[model samples]
Target: MWCWLYFYIFLVISQILYFSSLFFLFKVMDVFIEFQILCFNSVNVEMAVFLDWVSLMFSSFVFLISSMIILYSKSYMVKDKNLDRFVYIMVLFVLSMMVVIMSSNLVFVLLGWDGLGLVSYILVIYYQNIKSYNAGMLTALSNRVGDSALLVGIALMMGLGGWGYSSYMGDFFLDMNLIMFSVLIVLASFTKSAQIPFSSWLPAAMAAPTPVSALVHSSTLVTAGVYLLFRFSNLLSRESFMVFMYLSLFTMFMAGLAANFEFDLKKVIALSTLSQLGMMMVIFFLGSEDLAFFHLLMHALFKALLFMCAGVIIHSVGGCQDIRYMGGLVQAFPISSACFGVSSLALCGLPFLSGFYSKDLVVEVFSMSGMGLFIYLMFFFSVGLTVSYSMRLLIYVFIGQFNVLSLINLNEKDSSLMLKSMMFLLVLVIFKGSILGWMSFSTPYFIVLPFSMKLMTLLMILFGSLFGLDVLFSGVGQSSSMFGFIHFSLFVSGMWNLPVLSTSSLNSFTLNLGKLYLKNMEFGWAEFYGSKGGFNLISMILYEGLSVIRNHLKIYLLLMWGFLVFIVLLAIV
Candidate 1:
């Protein structure tokens, strides 16, 4: 399995076997593979696995994509001396993600959840550079918020029942503090999924290897939050759920705008990933868990392929990641360029592609659900932006005058490991949509809307294409002049700088509070009025009084005698 093609084959077989196993069972089943050692009294605290069509499909896709990434990394990281360590970290990330996917026990999920946080931090800083360190810290701390929220949510869930997911079924809903339980779960999901305020970390995490970015953005870390919320669908639908839905809308909009302005190849893709996550959250909130999960799996396939294609371009171009420094790449590397083209169009929800299947359904569901107009507008605008940036990316890199230094030779790496991995995902990028649409829905989502509103999606797709073509022809568009609004560009492109806000704002307050505590409690009041001060005062009095008494022994004796006589007289009276 360590061999390049061997791992892909093994993963394919495992996916087939696991998916096939689900058919023999007639109904939903929760399987608890318990560890007796972890149990205490009635709280068994077991390794519980939930088996359903959703779990099977998502888990299978995770492993399938992970196997492809491992093969891709074998070639991408072949030059690094620590390739072994990189592989180990990637393996651990997969295991952690599997735990999240398969475990029904909340504690077991945390085990995997924390594993993702810790390992992603390690991977993000794998470059061992200061930038990577800062990015890793932002990623870790931002996700820490979600992880802690999950912990609190888990504790809150215990009020209703045990920590296993199945415990939330039946009479559990009657016992819960609905507000706290629901809100905490949403907050946790928001952070993990990088909805709005927690979004800065997702882009920052692009400092990791492209494979890690592909894994994190596609199937692993970021998706953990959405998957979790889906798992807790019973606990999440409420008034508070609308708050996250709006946040997701803003995220989708913000990321779409940012990806258009971003010059970095990887960062652009990262923002694109963020926007799609927003779409998934909306699908979940709209009461379509099946559609959300379906999009998630399909997104994992195409997005991974997209990043892998980007990796090839980045590697072949002598590590230059800025799109401004690249152009006419289709002439040089036709194969890689073709893969990227398919991946980008799929991202834009080009008809008959993977994204088209789930994305179109999401929009249709929104039209018929009687939701507010604002949500519908934001979603379509983001979809337009999706195509705009994708077209902008294509124009900048694949179709234009060569924008490289004349002396620097450029050609395809032709690494078979990389090519084969991309080819595998390319197949999915083309076919997975149809496969998932058929498998996930026995009957299509039926929605009735006027022709004008129904054509909104198509119109936006057209408008976004034209905008992208304009961007392509605009003469190597500078980052500063992007979107024709510099300030808004910076605001959106920087993800509202939430990374700095989340980290610095939080750290600043905590630091100030610490200083106040040290000054007043530790140094001032504790020193003067606490035990040490009292002991010191008593010791000084004893020393001074004892010396005076020794020097004036007769006077001291007279005083003691008078006091004793007074006490005796009072007693007699």
Candidate 2:
């Protein structure tokens, strides 16, 4: 308790200092400090810290959200015996995230990168159950792909003669291996951000405690990928840019579909996080890394609140994670319900909220870009689908029938920890848009549009909202005997079987193949010929050499005669 209090105080002070620096000190000059650590053959290895407006602001946001998560975990993990360990891991995770935020050296970023992955794996399996372990493995291995790619990118970056990103920022165009470097970095970001095939693990990681989910999914780990891409946006623009755009679009759409179909509360939020990550990636691809960064920070604020509010609901429902088992929770936990409702609105880009400021800017920016119909359709359609799922979720959680068990203790008592943390985030979720919007960017974008174009986002949002409410209100999140729609539902709701393809189905196939290999090769042929049986056979042959030789005497004589003839032929030649 005291620890969280001190940590909260530290973060509050840290955020103030950062805000002060951004407004005052950084306006004069940036801070770039480095310590030379090693040298080899005229090559210098240094630990570099670069704090300009970006780092200061981002680090402050991270700490702000982190302090809230730590406080939230106090209530969330109150019953767990491993509370201290949980908080420790979260603190370490935040520290790792800060390292990623503050460092100008790619190597230091990797240290934080791997640290986030490792600590998240630990957090995911904190429950110590088979489910948690499996989820943890999936999360870790999926992340390992990105980590390996990042290492390769670092190796390739070394070819440019240094590992410090600040030195190479303006020279991205002159790099000889720009394509390879960009591809590797994009690939790394893709895995870390849970894009496409790597997307399964983010939802799977919901097996962790809710606090960890809020911390990991909100601002720190998944956003690490987008942060990397933003930092290297200059380097990734050539040739491979369209690919990231398409990937982000698909990820956004897929997550929206899956979340609409999902019954599990945590998984829905998790998929929404996946969708929002895609949104940020798309914004980054659209040539406004600053706006993307803006959305990233805003997303962290509201998404953290969304997950925490969901946690309070999950807790109130006596650990019931299925939204079908939840309803009328608003009547029991009004504050949590309020927080969830607002955060979901913020997530759906409600006007004047934290999400609105960045999301509106992104849509307007894209509209002005004169991009193709494909880009416009993908962005707007995904926006609509987002509203669809958000409405669907609201129906299941707040407006639908109260389907929870009658005997379950759904009380409003003992929400102090959750309420305190959520209330803090709630304030940020409301005002951070205006606050950061003013602080981060000075010039407002000029967007002139026709009437239809102006109403596009709203119309799409309305369509998706009606579509989601109509379908889900008719009982989608609840159990049904409608087997006809099952396949279509599975395809759409399961992300076209994406998470299954990436996780269960794929794992099953690989495990079966491994079993077959063990049966046919390792345990079958190798065991037969390379083990005790083969040894016995060799021993028998050695012991019965005279008898075996007598039986094969005619064959041996023929072989000797053929050998002699061959030798004679060779000698004659």
Candidate 3:
């Protein structure tokens, strides 16, 4: 009971801090813009000293999303036995995310980064189930690897005499290792963002509660990578740029493919998050920092909205998350279905929606960079896949005939207040780009819209919609037995095709080399002599020797005493 009380108190304090910090951030932005106006003519004033446009924009999104998630959690988590614990960790997670965005110093940023990771792990395992616990452990372990890279990057920055944000901004031009550190930082970002090999953990994290999934997986937490990259854009090197470009493109394509195959509603969103992160990375890599930031903001809004909607659907359906088990939910749950459809449209990059502006901006920037062929093709394909899977989600859960109505006692009521918080997010997803024009970091780059790019987006959406339509008309079928065989083959091949060389072989070679060296030297027997058992034998021999020495010492002391007594007698005489 005391623990519960303290947990509630902690939650209250955290919420207060988070909102207070957000208020301060807005104030800071106002002051910063004013300062820029007043000091534009002054040679002493530096733009970096104030909250830059990019930071201000991203911070606003962070604040908004964090606040919405907090509000939503209240109702979503009601009646949960671990309500206090959940509230406590959720608040801390939001607090850390806010700090990560607002902090000017790298050390403070890292503090927030690590704190967020820790809190997320706790939340992932809040259910204390074996599956959730394993998911949490895996996430924590992957994050640790990322954190180590970040720490090394920080160390490199410090070694170059960069102790604070001011120093980094002032000496950025002079620091040669800044490029190396920037590369390391991007590696950390990729891991945290859950790209490629590290991404497997994210889908597994669906084992977490929906609110945790909604906030952490879809919005604020995954955005941390893009945030870090944006934060350190000035120091990004050419090599790092290429690396990010390739990796982002690859991750985007692979995640899209994975999403196409996913059956679980949450896993689909999880993979979509990975794909979206990849798109954001590509934007950042192309030096379109403003566009990237806009994408990040748009992504947070729509993705979180979608996740919350999924949560509501899952809850209404008696915890049946398999899309196949759901149908006609649109008729049953109009409000949730509407919200989900809107968010999905945005996610699919539909025209005039939140995703279109941001995602199009990324594509526009890619084309302008003259490396358009591969990047555009990969992203184009992924966009189609996005539409396909999103439609699958919509039709599977919201369209088709009502099959699970009896199971869930289907109602037509709107989602709870917890789920309603997503409505605000939906509004933002629709209007954020217009509210904040493509954010400029150094210089505002004019976004050129191409007919080809617009056409490609439309075509992808059309194809995806058609595919979804086909599925809806044809009705759900038992996915071919061929799929199981394919999975088995992939698993077997992946297991057999060891990506890394055998450690046993390497160890055996080293042992053979050691044996050869020992044969070359007559005193190679010294190794055996220095073995544990040999050491024990030597110690026993030393013990015997020490006993003899101790006896001799005792006799010498007695003789010395006798000599001293004789000398005393002579002196007395």
Candidate 4:
């Protein structure tokens, strides 16, 4: 009955050993081992395994988080009849991520990439509800754009003679094919990571189970793009980096702003995930791949725990996801509330937490760089927005008045498995960053800044917390200005009309085109020129032939006799 849990436990033990060994190996030497399964004349068509410290570390984290989630789901989804199927799909999801992590060849990368996409769609619609169906569609279509870009990348890679992108790193060929490939790769990353226009689906995909959300948003689906970009960092053009830096920064700001305006508990976290992903991408484009990866690993640990905490809260509230209906959960479910607070604070990059290590390093590194004022201001501003939303989430969920019925049971101890999984990650969320930072970077980055510059991040967090408090208290009882406030809230909370743009605006035109196609092609043209038209034309011709034959038979005999007499007379003459 608990076979799945046993498998996950085995995976966790194996990954911990792998991570520790790989960490040491990475310190002593650079390890890049490639195994080829198939080879042709000059072109390699075989599935290959690429293992190094980076891939191994990421893979270990993936298994670690996955095992925790599966263990968590044992209690979270215990009542569901299809528990085995759920476990199976979760296994496939983890396996697909592993394939992507281990493969250097684009062919196998695409295989795993597509697997992630396909399996994600399946998971998104697992609830079999209308919302899940719509979310799945949005998720699928948004990712298809990335899939197309990768397919184009594969085509361009053929001109470069092989699918192994690892070999092409640092050897940037300034040719059209290479340039195009790099652009396509960035495009692919943008979609997979839910950048800008693709941002809507990440929030919508919250229709999935919270365990799936934790897995997808943290280490698997959304992070897949960041991982891909991390691998292809060297292949990217400076121009592409410059262009996408602004885009990724804008995406970060946008998601943070939206999260502050959002009332739905799960979506606020989803938007926060989007914001962090954008932060990772922007830093990567700004010439700090190591820091970005560091942030990514740190993020996965806490964000997954964050979602799990939210799941426990949601379950206790009897599936009500509206934070407006929730308040003072700290008193009811103290363990989950404490875990949620820790995770949210980590999200805000509070001092000494896991998120702070990478986030602080990112800030120091950016300040040290010679970027322009727009980049500098926007980066910190977005960081403030991050704190703002986390404050807003915490206030709405933990400090506000509890609006639910008193009869509801909000006990945390009942779900001991869930609590255990969360506590395991809870420990990491507190200390993983320092451990990871020490291990990943051989030497420390010595940042020298003015006193004012060093205090900027803390200042932003303080300002953001105040801003969140103001927003929460502002709209309480102002009926006169409520209309304008509602409109403003709608616009911001709707992600600046991105969901409409992605779904309705784009869909309206396509849906109309489909209607036109149905009317003209399937109905009008086919009816007039196809089987119906042919049948009618044949029937008319046959009727005319039969009528002509019947009428001509009588007249022809008379005419023939008269013609015969005239011919005989002429011959005689």
Give lDDT tens digits, candidate 2, residues 157-211: 7765668877876676677778888888888899999998788888889999888
lDDT of each: 0.82, 0.83, 0.70, 0.86
Off by over 4 Å in 1: 1-13, 21-42, 406-409, 471-487, 511-573
| Ranked by TM-score, top first | 4, 2, 1, 3
lDDT of 4 by residue, 1-573 (tens): 563665567476647746664665566645455666666767767566766678878888888888888888888898889988998898899889888988888888999999999999999999999999999999999999999999998887775667888776544474567778888898888999999878999999999999999999889999999999998887777776888988899999889888878889999999999999999998898899989999999999999999999999888888889988888787888888899999989988888999999989988898888789888888898899888888888878888877766546688867898999899999989998888877778677899999998988889888888777767767633454322443477688888899999898988988999999889988898888997899999999999999888899777888999999999999999
Poorly placed runs, candidate 4 (over 4 Å): 6-10, 13-42, 170-174, 476-487, 525-573
Q: Would you estimate the TM-scores of all the predictions? A: 0.85, 0.87, 0.74, 0.89
Candidate 1 per-residue lDDT, tens place, 1-573, comes to 354554666497558845653562335454546454364545555667776766767777788888888888888888888877788788889889889988888888888999999999999999889999999988888888878987897777665436886755766567547778777778878888888888888888888998888888888888998899889898654777677788888899989888877889999999999999999998788788888988898899899999998998887778889998888889887888999999898888889999899888888887787777877777888889899999999988889768975424456655778898899899989998997677567667778889998899999999888767765665333563345654465666677777667787779988999999999988888878987799999999999999887879788788999999999999999
Please give the TM-score that candidate 1 achieves against the real structure: 0.85
Candidate 2 — what's its lDDT? Answer: 0.83
Better of 1 and 2 by TM-score: 2
Off by over 4 Å in 2: 24-28, 170-172, 476-487, 504-513, 516-573
For lDDT, the strongest prediction is 4
lDDT at position 472, candidate 2: 75
Task: Choose the strongest candidate by TM-score.
Answer: 4
Instruction: Name every residue pair that clashes in candidate 4.
Output: none
